[model samples]
Target: MDDQTDSPDDYHAICLGTAARARGIATRYVDGVYSRFHPFPSRWLALAAGGREYLFASGMLLLKGSDPWRGLGLHINEEATLLIRDKQRAKDFLDARGFGTPAGRVFRRGDLSAALDAFSSFAGPVCVKPNQGTKGELVFPAIADRARYESAVRRVAARHQKILVEESVSGQLIRFFFVRPRVVAVKLSRPASVVGDGSATIANLIEAKNALRDRRAVPGHSNIVVDEDLRDFLAMTGRSLDDVPAAAERVFLRGTSNGATGADSLGCRADLHPSYLDVLAAACNAVPGLNLTAVDVMIRDPAAPARHGNYWILEMNRNPGLTPYHFPWRGEAQDVSGAILDAMERGFAPVPASPPASVPASTHSMPAN
Candidate 1:
């Protein structure tokens, strides 16, 4: 995960997925984890603009990674970084909206010592997460003490250009997928999810997650790390997967978003929610230029409904994935992609001019020859 670049596999998948739908090709989404085992030519990463870029992979981090066009799609992928790559710029926008976000303190490890005591003053249990690392690989959240917090910062400092100690909010984790002005899907995430048959152990449940190679296993997270935090949570609850965690019951993951290793996505259509729509509309106007983003939010209590009063905007995903936002099964909710593709094909709504003139300029200029 380079700061200036996106993971090749992640970028390539988006491009191919987008173009495949656009071109009417026999579309086949590939699994990234399994694909890595195959052979390929030299990998490439580049920036593209103004047209549909294409690449392949059901989506995974394949090492023998063959698809050479990964780099070529970087341009379209740049849309994703519109709100992410520049941390300061993103935080400033969120802070202006009256939403509580990570009170990120950017500093070198050496200077952090002097600022340590003060930083903890904002809130206790600050996290030392790399401004760039993926998953929870390099993030050290919950530094209850200053010494330990500083140490975590130093470790990260060795590798990163800067470190961010974010304010930790503990509660049910939620992720909201937005495509510009429209919020496609909002899911309440479980850090890690597994079904219980009243027999399998926690480890067994993990095995079950890993075993489903064909469908359930998502790329970038094919394997679950039964790290110390998970162990501690299991112990704290005085329970194990053997205790028969409720059917569709979630085993809580400590220090993570509902132990959600990406499974807690519950589809929500803000357009359908009246009260929430008001908030979304306000937010859209505030960030006028942003289109297509998945914003993470922490709703102290979400068991009720996704009505206003409780919604808080987290960071935005300029290029949110279409799969999670779309309905996976039959007849539940409208698939987000169907709407997005409809918009993409039917074309963006004609932007009315300020004076309501005879006709406004082309809203989305078609790609050049």
Candidate 2:
């Protein structure tokens, strides 16, 4: 079923549902319902008949099959899932467990001066983002100075009441998608980029890229927009969209590696260091009751240990989209969605109960249908 936080035409839900049906399970999309709250209208889907049904208001999956057997949404229980939604809270939990995360502080809408004060001691650029944002919205990867930082703060603060300011970490971005205790999929993620062919301007390259991107676009995927934000990002790098570069040179179109922003995900599960498996497992265990999580990490080199303290855990996503790993633009395809269903059929022992006051009713796990 579709929910407010997700698009009614969610491709992840579609792919997973198809996978389920291929295994003899039944599934179908629920009719579309409109709402003024979302930027655009969205819908939900469900299994027409099956062993059982689990309905959630925040996610797009409506599973019905294998009675008495249930799949946790992304293999994450409701409590831990909600806990990880707050970036600050999730960072605190991981930090306490000895998983090294970037040092940062949370600032409310009115606290710009304090944020600036905290940034003064940081080296180089800073990352500013909404505390509970997803799909890379309002996440500024690099705010180089107080002027830019303040501007970003004001812009981001208007939409999000809480903001996170952290020292910018530089490196290749990698995501470890874990299924329970094991790392099931790994991907190298990058901001949307266009390669120059020695003949076309950057703007022309972008248009060409968009042409191809639109042809393959799904519900969550999108064509890159050459908007003011992208122009500003280019200006900061001493370049312009009208500039042309040498053949094979790549120009990044945006700072955030969000698929909706046209970021690319390349499968790299086999390329990860062996040591990373254990370290990532520790990262997952940091959150109690969390069975599935996508851990964002940055590293200077792929051949070395990412746990050397220099590398940082950017964020944790409990309800991570699975299609990116399943059908990457480059690299090998992984069956991350299939793995999720596999974990669900295995069953989850009840977790230690969380305090009632800390839990929200809307975040409650659905009963088996």
Best by lDDT: 2
Provide TM-scores for the models.
0.61, 0.83
Write down the lDDT that model 1 would get: 0.48
| Residue-level error in angstroms, candidate 2, position 161 | 1.4
State the lDDT of candidate 2 residue by residue for 1-369, as single tens digits. 533232345667756766667777655544332223331223444543223453322333333332233322222355476678888888776665566678788998888677657768778788999988887888887778677787788888889888898878887788888777677888888888999999999999989998987787644457888888899889878889889988999998788888878888886666666666667766675466777678898866666765545567788885678778767888887887677667656644345576323321111111011
Give the per-residue Cα lDDT of candidate 1 at 239.
69
Tens digits of per-residue lDDT for model 1, 77-124: 233344565554566654555444556666655665644555546556
Off by over 4 Å in 1: 1-83, 100-102, 115-119, 132-137, 142-148, 193-201, 208-221, 228-250, 257-264, 268-274, 303-309, 326-334, 346-369
lDDT per prediction? 0.48, 0.69
Count of clashes, each model: 25, 5
Q: For candidate 1, which ten residues in a row score worst on lDDT?
A: 360-369
